[model samples]
Target: MVERLRGDWPALEHVLVIGEPSWDEFITTPWEDVRDPAVLPALRPDPNDVTLLIFTSGTTGEPKGVMHTHNTMVAANDPLPERLGTTPDSVFHMASTLAHLTGFLYGARLNVQNGATCVLQDVWDPVEFVDLVERHGITCTSAATPFLHDILRVPDLAERDLSSLTRFCCMGAPIPSAVVRQARERLPGLAVLGGWGQTEEGLVTLGIPGDPEDKIVETDGHPWPNMEVRVVDREGEVVPPRTEGALQVRGPFLFVGYAERLELTRELMVPADDGRGDWFDTGDLAHLDEDGYLRITGRTKDVIIRGGENVPVAYVENVLYEHPAVEAVAVVAVPDPRLQERACACVVLKPGASGFEFAEMQAHLAEKGVAKQYWPERLEVLDELPRTPSGKIQKFQLRAQVVDGPAG
Candidate 1:
C-alpha cells in the first residue's frame, strides 16, 4: 500500500502509519513516538483562517466543497449547548458519518464543546443503537428521519431499556408527521425533534425539547440565535406568513465559499445591500408561520408540476406517511406527454403489510382532506428508497425510474 501511494504521488515526503505494526517497516515515523509532548508544534491560527472543507451530498447535482473557518465553526457550535440544555454528565450517541456536516457539528464538536461524553458508531444499526443507549445512558443524538423509521421497526424495541434516551434530533429531510407520532407513542420519554439545514449554512433551525407536538412534527423549528431566515419571492421581496417561496438565510456561521469555485458561489448567493456577501439562497421552497417557525414545503427543483399546477411533494408525502402500512415514501415528478409532468408516489411498506394500490392511496388522501388534484396518479412499491449517505432520499433516481417506464 505504501509503494502504491508513493507511485501515485512521487512528491510525498513523509508517511506516518498507525494501528498495525506490520506496516512499520514501510513508514518513517512510529505512532508511539509522535505522542511525545516535546515533538508537537506550537501553532496558533487566526479566527478567519480556513479550517475545514466539507462536501455537499450531491442529491440535486454535483457536490461542491464548502469552506469553513475557525470563526464560522465557533459561531455554529456556540449556541448548541445552551439550546440543547447539555451538561457535563450528558452522553451523546452518534451514528452518522463524521464526513457529513450533521455528524461534524452535533456528533463531534458539540459534545467536545460541552465537555460531554460522545460515543461514536462507525455504522448505523437500530438494534446496536438501542444497546448503546442503554449501556451508555445516552442523553441525546441526531440523525435523519429514516433512522427514526428503522428504530421503530426493531422487533425488540418495546422490550429494550431506552429510558436513557431523551432527545432525537431528526435532520437532512422533511420528517413525516406519522413517524413523529409513532416515535412519541413507542418511546414516550423521547423528544423527537425536526430540523432543517444545509452544508452551506450550518444548522439554520431546530425544534427545542418543549415545542408543541404540531410544531415538532409539522414544522422545522425557529432559527438558531444570531441567525436570520426569510421567505422571499423571485424579486427578492419578503413574502407574507404561510406563503411558500424561496428560503434565504444570513448568519455568522455561514460558509466562506465553494472551494476554488468563486463564480459558482456568487451565483448561489445574494449580496447584501451593505456590500457584504451575507444572504445565501437556500434553493428550498418554504413558508414561515406567524410565530416565525419555518416549514420546508419542498426544494425549488424537486417540485412536481402537473397541468400547470404545482404539486406540494413534501406535503403529499407527509399525508401518505400517516397511512399505517407505509414504512417510507417518496413523491417524484414523472414525465407526462400531456401534462408536462405527473406525480408518482413510491412507497416502502412495513413488514407483512400488503395490498396497497393507487385507488387505496387516493381514498386515503381523500379521507385526510387532501385535494384530489394533488393525489398521486401512480403507486410503486419498493423494498427501500434510494438514499444518500446522509439519509436523504434521492428523488432524482425515482424520477429516472418513472421516466424509464417502470421497473420489472
Candidate 2:
C-alpha cells in the first residue's frame, strides 16, 4: 500500500489516507512542485469520463480500481435521498469506511447535494457515535448490520437519547428478524433497512421504510425505479419466482469495467436480450419471492471476511487442514465493529490427535504466508458436524448452532 501510494504521488494532486494504526511511513513533496487543486463542487467531464477510481474489495485477489463516471454515480444516488426521506434537515453519519461507495455517497455526496451537515468520525465508536447524533442532530446513519448489532449491545444503550436517528442502513450484512423487531422497539423512529449490492454494482436494491418485518429481515426489497434485476440459472435462463439462481442486475448504476482489468470486468458485466440492457452477475445464490423480494443465501466465493478485508476462506481452511488435529472445518463470518467480519473456525477434531490445540492451528496458519488476518477468534472443536443427505456441509445450520455467538 505504501509503495503504491508513493508511486502514484506524481499523478495525485491530493491524497488522503486514514487507518487506525499509526504509520511510520512519510511522504514529503515540495509545495512548489505539488499539484494540489482547489476543492470545488461541480466537475465537467467528457461523456465517458471517470469521476472516481474505486477499488474492489479484493475478495479474489488484489483489489482493482474500478472507474465510474458522474452520470453513473448520480444515477445511483439520484433516487436515494428522496426515496429515503432525507432532506436538507437530515444530518448523515457513516459508520463504515469512506472508501466504500455507499459511505462516499451517503456521507459525502448526499450532504453536499442536500446541504445537510455531515459528521465525520475516525472509527465506529458507539459511545462517541451516540453523542454525535445528539450533538449534530443527526437524523440518518449508514452502518453495516454488524455495527447495528454492536450498538444494541452497548451497556448504556437505553440510557442514551438516540432520538435523532431516523434510519440506519447497510448492505450484505443482514439483520435477523428478531434483531429488527428489537430495533423497532428500542429505537421507535429508526428504520432498519437492508440494502443489496456489491462494489462492482452500485445501489441495486433496498428494503424501504415501513416495510413488513418479515420482508425487511428475510429479503431485499423490490427494484427501484428504472432498475432492472432478475434471477437466472446456470445457463443464464431466467428462473421462476421461487427457484434459486444467480442474481443479475441491469441498471444505470452499473460500471463499464474495472480499470486495467478488462477480462475481469468482462466476466462481471454481460450482454442482455434487448441490447439496451447491461447485466452484471452478482455472484450470490438467491431466490426471489412472488413479490420480487430477493433473499441472499450463500456467496459463490470463498472469501473469508475477517472484519472488512476479504480473507480467502478456502485458502485459510486449507492452511488449517494441514494441522493433524483437524478432522473437518468450516470458517464463517462473525461480526465485529473493528473488522466488519471476524473469521471463526469450527472444527471436528481427529479422535486420537493430542496436543493439537486451537493455538497450535493458529500458529500453523501464521507460519504459512496465510495472513494471520484470516485466523478465527472463536474456534469450536466438536465431536462431529451435522451434514445433509448429499454429504454437503450446511453452513447456515452450523451458523445458527455455532457462529452467531457474542461478538469480540
Candidate 3:
C-alpha cells in the first residue's frame, strides 16, 4: 500500500510506519518513539482548517467522508465532560475504534479534555471488560447497546466487582427496555444512558445520570448544550410532541461538509424557518415528547410498506427484543409481489434456544398488543446480525441476505 501511494504521488516523502520493519527507504519505529519531542510536527493547525475526515458507518448506504475542522472537533468534546459527568479523577475506557466519532470524541478527546486516564481495548471481550473495570477502576465508558448487552451476559457478572464503573453511555443504536431493566437489576450502581448522534454531528442527546427508567429506556434523551434538535414533517414544518417526523440538528459540533461531496451536503441542509440557522437533516425518524426528550423511531429509508401500510420497524423490533429467547432482533423490508414490501424479522437467539417459530413471534407481538399488520410476516434465525465495528446493525445487508442468501 505504501509503495502504491508513493508511486501514485511523485511529491510523497518522509514515510514513517509504526510497528513495522524498515525496508526500501521506508522508516520504521516503535509506537512509543513517535511521541518523542524531536519527531512531532511543529506546525499548528488553524481552528478553521479541516483536521479530520471521518467516514460514516455506511449502514444506510455508501460511506461518506465527513470533514471536521479543528474548531468543530474541539466543540464536539466540550459538552461531553458535563454530560458524561467526567472529572480529572475519572478513568475512561474505550473499545470502539477511534476512527469513528464516538471513540474519537469520548475515548481520546474527552480524556484529554478532562485530564483523565483512558484504557484502550484492542478488541471487545465481555470477560476481559469485567477484568479491565476491576483492574483499572474504570469509571466512565461510552459504547453501543450491544456492548452493554454482552456485559450483562457475562457468566460471572454477578460475582464481579464492577462498582468502580459509574457510567455506561450507550450510542450508535437504541437501547431496548429489556436491556435497561436487566442492567438496573444487575448493576444498580452503574447508570446506563442512551444517546443519539451521527458521524456528521457528534453526540447530540444523552440521558442524564439520574433519569427515571422511562426516560432511560423509551427516549434517546435531551439535547446537549449548544445543540438543537427538531422533528419536522415532509413539508418541513415542525411537528407537535409525540408525532414522528424527520430529525434535524444544528450545532457548532457539526462537521463542515462531506469531503468532495459538496452537492450532497447542500441537499441535507434545510433553511430554518425561525431564522436561527440552517438545520442539517439527519435522515432519521424521531419524535419529541412534551418534556422535550427525543425518541428515535427508524431511518426514513428503513420504513417497511406492507399492503400500502407502513410498519413501524423500530417499534416491532423493540417488541421482539422482549422475548426471552431472543438476544438481538432487526426488522427489515423484503420485496413482495402483492405488497411492495413485507416485514421480515431477523433474529439472533440466546444460548440454549432451539428455535423461534413465526407462529411464536406472532403470538408474542399479539400479547404485546401490536397490530397484526405491523408484525413481521416471516422469522429468519441467524447466528449473528451483520454489524459495523461500532456495533450498528447493517440492515441493508440483512435485507439482502433475507431476500437472496448470504454471500459465500
Q: Please list the C-alpha lDDT of all candidates, in the order they appear.
A: 0.88, 0.71, 0.90
Q: Which structure among the candidates has the greatest TM-score?
A: 3
Q: Rank the candidates by TM-score, best first.
A: 3, 1, 2
lDDT tens per residue, model 3, 247-314:
99998988889999999999999876787778999999999999899999999989988988889889
lDDT score at residue 282, model 2, on the 0-100 scale: 77
lDDT of 3 at 292: 90
lDDT of 2 at 172: 44
Q: What is the C-alpha RMSD of each candidate to the true structure, in Å?
A: 3.4, 13.1, 4.1
Which pairs of residues have clashing backbones in candidate 3? none
Candidate 3 regions exceeding 4 Å error are 7-12, 19-43, 273-275, 406-408
lDDT score at residue 169, model 2, on the 0-100 scale: 75
Predicted candidate 2 versus true structure: per-residue lDDT over 1-408, tens digit per residue: 755787767665544454422221224444334544442224435656888888766443456787888878778878887668888778888766678776777777878877888887777677788888878888887766546756676778788888888888756444455557668877888888887776766778887888887788778666777788888988989999978777888788787778888898788876877876878887777788989887765566534565466665545565676565665677776666877677778777655777456677768877876766667777877666555321235566666666555432
**Residue 194 shift from truth in candidate 2, angstroms:** 0.5
Lowest lDDT block of 10, candidate 1? 35-44
The local lDDT score (0 to 100) that residue 377 gets in candidate 1 is: 87
Error of 2 at 172 (Å): 3.2
